[model samples]
Target: MARIKLSCERGRSIELDTARTALGCIDFQADFVLPEGRAGALGLPIEVLLAALPAAQRALSAAREAGMFVFFTRECYAPDLSDLNAFRRQYDVAIGSPGPLGRFLVKGERGTEVIADMRPRDGEPVIDKAGFSAFHQTTLDTVLRVRGIDTLLLMGYTTQCCVASTLRQAVDLGYACILLADACAAYDPADHEATVRVMYSEGDNFGWVSDSQRLADASQSIEH
Candidate 1:
């Protein structure tokens, strides 16, 4: 078992276990992160997306130094749109044509690729998910099981959507998750705040919330 550390805030705390924990970055792809990317086209706050970048990078560095596993998820849909749900298709129409990004979330498109700064390093796993939840229609569960990752430290785009959805599923699947609140954002600040408040609730109904710096400090104590 990995050594466990506790992070407490506002009368709540989450345990962080080094060996059993992994940093799961959800949907940090160009479509969502870049200022001129798909998210901007949809009128989602590109600033909100960009704001989490530095914190995410810091967390990744800390996890790497601590010998923790890191996984990046990309929201990819089939080129033929077979994999897109009604909401996504509708979103595509709302965002107008995909422009140079190749029709929104279609796989193999530049917009669908992970952003340059957030790219996965050697040995890091990149999981392609077709829906809001990384666990939905993806091999994330299998990967985590095989690697023995009992806990997940989450970060990435659209806090109220993909991030929240994955966090909920992760809890149900019996994995302890800590949402890096400062490392995740949404199109709306209110949405982001509400999601964090729910996760950071007294009883920890879903998981816990912490900023990247706190998580990094906690990971640093593991003595890699």
Candidate 2:
């Protein structure tokens, strides 16, 4: 298998097997990242999330070019809200509420779709998840395992929430994970930085932390 060395935090690095790696884009949907979507409707800061779009796009392109399996995750619930958990229902009042872009976080709604700037390509799996962790009650794990993917390159909106949750779960599931820091964002810059620090802390106890530029550069250097 062809391999590439990815430089990680704490002066560490890891080998990425192009054939065994997959790029997992988490919750880059309109509800989370777009200015005219739920976040904006709720008066949350969408600019920070939008700022990551360029890096995310670059990483997505690089992953596709390198022949790595690419998958995207969108956080949404059933139209009837039957799939929504009690905890989420109690806290996220906007889940089924109408917003600028249809019903917020409702399946089949425009707000639940991945943003146009970094839409998934044809044949790339787009997993619809009801929870922050993409693996929770989703087919993401099975899809990855079926493809023989053992490593994940993860990036997307809300570093402190969906991205962090998915990365932690991926670690627990025994997948070698790398987080693309610059390709993710949170409403609060402090929260984003905090998540990045924790990811690389404890000698990268959870997973390796990296940036989208480095990932893109390395992927581009791979020989086809």
Task: Identify the candidate with maximal TM-score.
Answer: 2
- Steric collisions counted per model: 0, 0
Instruction: Estimate, for each residue in 59-150, the C-alpha lDDT of model 1 and write its tens digit.
Output: 88988877889999988877777777788677656332465576677788888888988889998988988888999988899999998889
TM-scores across all candidates? 0.91, 0.96
Which candidate number would show the highest lDDT if scored against the true structure? 2
Please report the TM-score between candidate 2 and the true structure.
0.96
